[model samples]
Target chain A: MGKPTGFLEFHRELPANRTPSERVSDWEEIHVHVPTDTLKRQGARCMDCGTPYCHTGKLIGGMASGCPINNLIPDWNDLIFRGQWKEAAVRLHQTNNFPEFTGRVCPAPCEGSCTLGLNDDPVTIKSIECSIADHAFEEGWIVPDTPGTRTGKRVAVVGSGPAGLAAASQLNHAGHTVTVFERADRVGGLLMYGIPNMKLPKSMVERRVRLMANAGIRFVTGVEVGRDITAKSLLSDWDAVVLCCGAAQARDLAIEGRNLSGIHLAMEFLHANTKSLLDSSLADGAYISASGKSVVVIGGGDTGTDCVGTALRHRARNVTQLEILPKPPASRAPDNPWPQWPKVYKLDYGQEEAAALQGADPRAYSIQTKRFVGDESGQVREVHTIDIEWKKSPDGRMHIVELPGTERVFPAELVLLALGFVGPEKKGLVHELGLKLDERGNVVTDGEKMTSVAGVFAAGDMVRGQSLVVWAIHEGRKAARGVDRYLMYGQSYLP
Target chain B: MSDAIWTAGEVPHVLFVGDESGCRDELTAALGAGWAIQPANDGIHAMDLLKHPNRPASIVVVLDLSMPVLEGFGFEKARRADSELSHIPVVLVTSHAADERVKKFGARAYVKRPIVVGDLAAVVRELGEG
Candidate 1:
């Protein structure tokens, strides 16, 4: 919309990524900043279409199609086009409670649904959004928007992940006394530990936490809700409770030799790496280093990708990611269309870096690990794999049929199970509260975002199962509105 | 019209009814999100698009509240009154801050302009049942 013919004039381009070879030497962010003038030119390609699908948070073909929090994509695109940086920040913050996290880590589904993408390359909505948010931070336009009047109400948000932080932010804006309880030593759950520092520096997460603290949201870390203070006591102490506990029960690989010493859950490995990096800048030896070892990452998703990147950073001799599913087509399939989430092959930053160093993609698709072959010292030394073929069974259910005589073994001292999470852990908090769980083990909630228990609510990964940061923010905002409604009979100033 | 949306197997056909350039542009932009978008100046033109070969198995209507020939309320009424268009759901797009006509016309959702196009697309998804 900035320039009527800008789409024709300018091609869809982003900041040149730091060369894979140079970036792997350290844990700094991989992307280099593009000039402000270039971003403006990119914004000029907004096309002012009658309909913009980029912000549609709807699920198409069972996958996310647009920004889940429904960021006003076109508004910021226009604002950036006009170089009205501050106004763009205001519009961005209106929807996304945390754009910097999403800007860094999120796979940009909004761009896939871009109107221009149907004809040409989609507008660089994510980059533009990031530029606006980052610029806001640089200009010091982002300050504590603390509520003017106190509502004399108390709300406790459990687990200091994206969802809990978002809920706290909204409730604080609505003039409610909010306290976020985190079991971790630090405030951010996944943001601080689960995600590696290179992608999102912990300083960014800390900056937001400090801002929330200034905005009147109190954070109580190193305190598990059901353990330290029983769920019943918190129910009495706080007027309303929101469970933002993430789905962190990592799905374990039950293959033979799972008891091997070197095999670790993806979260455990990442958590140690980040904590050690923070403690002594990787000098404390608190983390499981993949240095000088052949590492085999089981499962080929974001978690697996992160493991590969982390192992490479630690100077692993070689890294291989085994994916159970067959490789996706290089292009979108007929069933997968525009505006819907495309199932195309993409070499993410991790895979890109691995390729640059190893001279090939680190992923080995349609492969399954049969067992972790260990050495005499009882440490994983190699992983045996077999090829798999998926076919429809007689009952019309698809089954993974093992292909014959494709057995192969790869040397490995470290084997990280980067398999995805199953659901929220149900032993402590869920058991103590007696919360109702859906068939898939997620907390069940009503239309009002209120859980089965009265005045108690659930949001984010706890309710939606494991999902993107954007959805967590969306749920957090909704749960806060529900809490506000419960506190003041239908008079919630929360959006 | 020969675009990615057309190449994709099948998608919901959205009939847009409005008199302003904003409405036309909105319809044109919606095309990028892989919908068979049919733009009409008013209710009558929209109905014509629905009758042609573009007659989609699943269709949703996006109507602007105010127009020259047929207003949103009239368009919805006419649509409901006719048997052929009764099953089709309508979503209202309005520029006015305080528009209550959408409620009267029974639009599934109303997206205010300085619009986020995603809102309209989301409502269409809900109504399209896709």
Candidate 2:
């Protein structure tokens, strides 16, 4: 617990983000550094209840209501209140393998489930969590904790995303020889390419990968499991195999004129922008340029917001995000009670930046794209859309009804589909290994996270479909335990 | 729970232990082809479906925590007590997060409220295949 009267004495506060006009100009992080005193006072506001739901890591309303990895949140919050930054970092790392990544990208479900949120604002848990990790890094508290003794077994991890990395880290710490196979030229899967640098600096990903490598974890980049080497070969070579290959199959809007030249998946636009930016600082001109173009981003999710932000950074003429779902309420509805993730509307970083620059928020809610109108040259020129209403039928099933005479068109040269992912790509390693797929096309796993094959296990988005990075880490850790137990004759020391 | 086996049509692959509402049809549609869904008013009806001798070979039970007769926990207790049905996987659906005790009850996974079709389908399919 924190200070007894801390919640009463102090109000919840967070460090102000960098001015959108300023931060959007460069690829630097959006947050402005907060003073240690301010962070400490903020930490003191935690009212640790008799039963803390912040670390329950439970799913409510099909969404994460707390920390997915179940970080000892109160302990760390108390530690931070006492100004014991190092101890806070230790408590964080005990559960989350990479607080640095989560501290940046996580939507802070912990805050949503904070007991204090029942009345007043919740504790500034996310900012405090981030500050603890950042402080640890600055003071050199984080390092490669190589195991003293090595187990004779070897494990192979496919897809070096959050899940793959978490599994690899845990397995290596358990004294097993671990090899992480990544298809990308760089180490991180989504961390490297899927996310923009401004959100999660590539250096952070590289730093962690470097530490793991130093701890004797072999990273083989640019090697596809089913293509570079056969999945059968990996199964034969390693004592156990874990599939951390993310659910990368992006959902498509296969409407009319989908084959137009300028239409691109959100990942393609993001991956190239980051790669080119990192590779040559955009001087090489290898990315799909949004410069001087009207950008239309379909699907109003985090990925869509990222596209909007990136398009703004590229100095797009204009940007608009089309969301098929109705706008959420400004405050939590009666049904979305305490300890449940409040289904409320709030502008994300990208939307904030867009609003700061543009006259209005760049989101068009309850709209559906009819078709992409392309020119004779096959370059997408405009996006046709119509407003829609959502109504629950007599049967209690929600259905979309297109509104009449509400058609609108927006000029666009670039159409980014941020409609989210379907599931793991089934063509390569998943197919080669003959793994069973769920109805939604995610890899099917048993209770132990083991796939249909005895020696092979799957985790993360690959098994759970497209999900948060925190959940990926959770899955990765679980799969590591499963793999360890199998290799050690139904015994495992991994937590 | 009755021991009467299903005789007509295909024995349902899933025993949905929850309210008799739109969720069953929604789940059935979301589960797509090959999955035949049979609804239960509560845990009691679910037990009867489980006890059927002609139940599908790869059947799974999707239970809701808050229900009328023989709730999810109670059904789990009775199901686990039976040696023949103990190994079958059960996925729990709830509006709030279930505590760690659910894992001790042998629930394979949890699907929260405001259910996403894809997510529920994935969990049920994985548990069914298991």
Candidate 3:
């Protein structure tokens, strides 16, 4: 409520993005920074409702309706309205461990739960959050906060993804000597490899990782917890060990011609592409080439969209995404009202690029692939598909029903499956520790986030299954708190 | 507060137990289905609506689970414990499909949200059948 008429005076405006033509040619982020003046006006648009729904963080309708980490939305909005940059950054960091990662990647459930969204467009909370973080970096407000005293306790974090990094950072803050072990050649797991340079530039990940290193947190890359080093040794050496290894066991499509040469998991395609791009500027001849090929990506989530964008960057001849469900409505449906995460159709960055290069959106809704038709040499060259409709069951549940006489095929040389992850791979460290997994294959933890074993804690995707980056950070922070309590006998300093 | 309550109708009631937009429109659609709609800003208000006799006899309590004051789960618990209100069936109207978790909370049926008025009416009629 900075300006009584602020919501009326200034309409919602997002910061400008680089033209698709300019951005798709290179591996850089699409968004351009908006000046402080525009941000202040956007901040003014926040009604600051008596009970701001933007930070409630409740799981409404199975999706997060607000900030998962519960960032103080109104406080930061007010700070921006009052021209408090450093204070805003500090407030932003109070709840969130890293807003930079979220600001760039999170789907912004906060905006969906905004009170103004009841009638008018919601305030640009995500943009404001990103601006605060970027401004903090530019002003040199972001620096290492090494603990003044030592706790004489050691913790080994199993993964170097957001969860592990956040846990390590928080544990370091509590004066516990912390070490992060990453299986990958570089520190970041999904952040470094799964996501492309266009969505989140590698420099940002490196910058944050470097800052954490400067803060006295030790990082050891290429040292896997179960293989390079034994889990028993890690458990014996460290006072407490927290497992943050993510759920990466991807869901696969089992069909005829599944053994074709061209079909690959979305992560494999994305990981190899990113590693090559980073290692030798794509001169290494390592990644699955989508160039001069008609690619059919078999999912419609963030990963599939990333594949589409990656293929476009590699100058693919054509690309199509097959979505099993029908296209979502352009506007929020009645059941998907405010504060319940509006399930409206939105064109993401990759979809936008595809639309710009091609004449239409690359997705085909209500379609299911039956088989992978291959060429003479066993390389996939075509995909067989059929249209479908949803039918209600006796239990009143909706199920996909294939339409009659709608079978068709597309010429596809490269096929990527982005059907999402099943759960954490229950192979290495998990088996070594004899960790108890839930029915869904995720590690089972108690109220204290500790596994069945004493002095061993678990967090993030390994425990909760595949989830968003924000949840990983939240779980990491929670796990850090649990680890601290176990070390200090119910007294903990982790926030 | 007065607009959210109406005592004149003989239609079966479906209490919308949340204050957000999804709750509002669902209740409004319930009214269109010839059912008396009771609006409670949160679970606390919902509990208040269920206790009084002047209110219509509610057949199904549609829950949003994301209310501010008293959560959807807590509200269902309080309802189940009460001798007078325990028998009333609940239809969980949420974005995600209702699953075993909803059944644990005493929900009889569910309508996946982004809800169509007709679909909700159909489910309510089916679940509300004698």
Candidate 4:
């Protein structure tokens, strides 16, 4: 490490955010940029621990604890401290194809496993990495690396989300002609539409896409391989096909009045809102609005938080987010220690915004929506809800049980179901290709990441179901190695 | 030719249709008074409102590209096929501004979110007048 005494000299410091009151007035990102000097200081805090658990990427307590992609955290942090930003970017790109996306959205499990965090604060690894990546973009250090020679073999990657992008980038680097097929009008699936612009600006996504295009990766949009172009056609034209289609199917709340006019899936709300915002601002009502309405958001996850933040920005008269689970402890529990993801209560941006305007956190823990109560006109007016209590079953597993006399009516002109996704939609390409599916309905692949069909592989949410973007990139890279071995040696390279 | 009766401090009605509820709320709050707002949870309901004989005149439809049971694109295609709803202007809102589909589909314009309300309202006002 460049600065041996850096951790002793500097305490961990992250970039401050705009005050909640000032930021709630608009939809811009809340976190302000930390000056280069402050970021360098934060980077210097990397301890260069002997074990370096930050990059170990092991699963602790059934949750990811470190960098799944094994990003060279200490190396990059040291590079940033030494003013070697160009080298830091190079090291960052070695493991991650899109640090920009992860820097903004990833939970940064690396910090959780940081050695410095055991005693004091973690080395602001996430912030330092983002700063280096952003600096690289500004200095024109990040550019497309075109293959030295064309391999003549062609590969078709379905979906243009992170997994597909990573896979395509790697395979193209291996000198193979790669074409990414997207059902939507654009390539970056969730990155393009599901994620809001404030979190990840579309300009950044387009910038990388433009560079990839320049590198000879052909992005074919508005093409649904199953319907628009048959799967059979893909097998005939391309030597290999990679199914990176994300878990696009959302889980629905099957309850009374489920067909009400105002009830919607969280992705439906997020996808539409992003589309409207991208289309022509508020000129076209491509998204749903919550102005002067009482909004009820179901489920309590990142997607739900996104809904809460979006609703608060709409100036909803009232907003309430319902979570079936009990609120987490404010600090890490005894069982949850260092090097494990701290399952503690922390306010995300959306909740922070909602709290600023609504005078309290919008979330209602241990509550479940029973039904949608609609007006005579069939528009949703309210939601019937009940408080639930968790009880340990005979087997010591937790189960939700409704509490008596805890029923209440919540006014809700707009209701968003923020429950997570199930799996990729099986119709169209999946059904046409007849890909093998696991018991849970996710695409089934062997340890080699190969589907039942020959020369066909799957990765990302398509195989693993809905998961973090970092995991998707990891699977994509691993699957690319598997594909490379299959193409060259007719065997699997993944161990 | 005649002045349309409007709610006090209302600019004009702008209807948002799609699924993500949070984003809709943010847009509405940001665009407060710059535009009156209505939201449909999905595409079928939005299409029904657009085709209604008593439909709010001069209202803009902000359409999301994806949805269950009649997504924004499907609604747009169906609206284009309908003689009554076809004239209404649709500003396509999306996460993917650079997606080729936006260009091919010929939306009135594309706007990215989470956008500042002032910027969003300005775009709506421009389209409303035109």
Q: What are the candidates' C-alpha RMSDs?
A: 18.1, 17.9, 21.7, 24.4
Q: What's the TM-score of every candidate structure?
A: 0.79, 0.79, 0.79, 0.78
lDDT, candidate 2, at B29 = 89
Ten consecutive residues with minimal summed lDDT in candidate 2 chain B?
B1-10
Deviation from truth (RMSD, Å), model 2: 17.9
Worst 10 residues of 4 chain A by lDDT: A486-495
| DockQ scores of all models, one per candidate | 0.01, 0.01, 0.01, 0.01
How many clashes does each candidate structure show, in the order listed? 3, 1, 3, 39
A442-465 per-residue lDDT for model 4 (tens digits): 999887689999889999999999
| lDDT for each residue of candidate 2 in A151-174, tens digit (9 for 90 to 100) | 556899999999999999999987
Q: What share of the true interface contacts does each candidate keep?
A: 0.00, 0.00, 0.00, 0.00
* Candidate 4 per-residue lDDT over residues B34-63, each given as its tens digit: 567777766655765565455666788888
Cα lDDT of model 3 overall?
0.86
Q: What is candidate 3's lDDT per residue for B17-114, written digit by digit as tens?
A: 76556646755765575666667676656766676667666467778887654567767777787789888878787765546666565578777767
Model 1 DockQ, alpha carbons vs. true complex: 0.01
Q: What is the lDDT of residue B92 in candidate 1?
A: 76
**How big is the positional error of residue A490 in model 3, measured in Å on the Cα after superposition?**
0.4
lDDT of 2: 0.88
Give the poorly placed runs of model 3, Cα more than 4 Å off: B1-130
Global fold similarity of model 1 (TM-score) = 0.79
TM-score of candidate 4's chain B against its reference? Answer: 0.79
